[model samples]
Target: MSYSKQKNKIRLNLVIALIVISLFSISAGAKTLTDLADRKLSLPDKIERIVAIGPGALRMVVYLEAENMVVGVEEFEKRNQQRPYIIAHPELTKLPVIGPQFGGDAELIAAQNPDLIISSYLSQAEMNNLQAKTSIPVISINDGSPGSMTEAELKMALKFLAEILNKNDRAEELINIFDQHKNELKSRTSNLDLGMNVYIGGIGNKGAQGITSTEANYPPFEYLGLNNIIEDDKKSNFTISKERLLLENPELIFIDQGGIELVEQDLKREEFKYLKAYQENEIYQLLPYNHYTTNFATMLANSYFIAETLYPEAFKMLEAKEKANQIYKQFVGQPVYSEMAEIFGGFKKMKLN
Candidate 1:
């Protein structure tokens, strides 16, 4: 062969090899959706900074064990803010104003210079607009239904997070742990005769309506083997009137933070002071764990607390504080059990008349 022709052939092979390498890089780093309606979600080369815009996303971050990666959150995203898992972390509370949970300050989110944005459900227009304007990718996961969140959805979300954080083994371990606790709780309380007259009061300040006394929001109460007394009583979601609460006269009432405030306000009124929940003290306040009701971790915590409160003898096999510590350390990855206990302490031993 001519020397010039041979040299040209060698150069052509080098160009082809370079092209193949480029294609491989693109494929290996491609973004993907983990579930339904999920967009082209993929992890950055390394997710050193992230902005979690919803409570569900916060739960995902906690499960991924990426608490330190979170750079921002929605206005109402509660958790380690006051005394968080990481000391000196920026509190979303004092951060610049976002319009609301769904509508945060886009400019501020950009300013945070996050590698990825994790969100739950956002309106289509909002999501699309943000994607177009921002260089960072926004990945969303479903929050499941209000009737009850499914284990399937939780698993799916966790898997996506695991892929992003490169913690597949830890994610699987968390799921296994979650399933173990769930099965144990279900089995232990399966035959407890958890009769009717269980009520969950008031929505949160951010407008989370509590569980329907009926089948509408059945997951949490149903999980615990309790019947929500107000499920069918009201057609719409709102705070139950004193008359309704008095009439239902639930055996147990779970008062949310907002509901607790409302009831406290009403107690000043002579008329509402004598209601069954009030007089009997059957109400249990649900402290805000991550700004919303009932995630997997919160549900487990709530279940243990409620089980001890309802069937003390059965749960007497284990100490409640120990149970709390186990959940905090194993699941939440934060073993500040004493601090969490203090925050949740008020709800533990309150008498419900």
Candidate 2:
């Protein structure tokens, strides 16, 4: 071939190469996707910088053992600054606090350099605003409901956490353990005569209001195969009066943190001590601090304590300490065996009279 002809062929090849490169760049740009929550999101192969916007989401990160990757946390971090685990990580405590969905410093969030943001139950508008403010991806998960969120939701969230953190194995393992334990609990309680008189009592001195039988409190009662005895409160996070509570006389009373304090003070009055729950000793306190904080291990611990107490004969094989450690390793990725041992050290074993 002549030299001029060879040069022309080379020019044609170069033009084609440039066109292909341009197309590839456009395709990559097209992939900038948004999720159901509408937070600007891109599913990059890995996540290194994470921002958790809700207390529940933050707790999930702690459980998933991805605390190191967290770049920022919301206002709750400030409230929990003095909390032992959080205090140990001074950097997290020092990070700037952001407001909730209603209002937050969007510019401040962009400056933090996050690769992804996790939220729980955020409205579409709030999500869109965050996406607009940052180039990072945002994913949202639903908190478990009294009976609404099934195992599927847990696995779905786990898969999302795993994929985002690049720890698929750990997520699968954690999910499997929960499923296994739940099934075991069901089998054990299948035959028990779990009374339907369930009551949620707060520790306030003035006598806390009761949840109407319709409301769902937590997973323990449901997981243990016990029937919900309390009537549902029409509104969420409601308060009840003493007159209504006396009428229900629930067989089982589960107290949130500070609940027992109220009980202790109120029951001291001669008239209050005479109530059936007080007299029958059906009341039990939900362990403090950990209950509201969003840690899966804590939830599991709560579940075990409630189930084991209510059906001691069936859960004879359960070693609460060992189970707690399994959850810690599966999610927290840290062996909290000794630390948790202290936390659960004083649990009073339930005695069925």
Top candidate on TM-score is 1
List RMSD in Å for every model shown: 13.5, 14.4
Worst 10 residues of 1 by lDDT: 17-26
The candidate scoring highest on lDDT is 1
Candidate 1 lDDT tens digits, 22-114: 322234766444433434444566678887764466667776777777777666544344332321234445544433565466787887788
Instruction: Please give the range of 10 consecutive residues that has the lowest summed lDDT in model 2.
Output: 205-214
**Candidate 1 — what's its lDDT?**
0.58
Which digits, one per residue and each the tens of the lDDT, describe model 2 over residues 1-353? 34795688457545533432332211353334333243334556545887777435665666566788887666667664433345335567676766542234567677788777777556666666777777655676553232223344555555656555766676656766776666566667767887557755542222232222123454666667665554453432345665666666666666643344445565566655555766777766544333233344555665776777777777778866566566556555544655543543323422323
Local accuracy by lDDT, each model: 0.58, 0.55
Cα displacement (Å) at residue 256, model 2: 2.0
TM-score of 1: 0.73
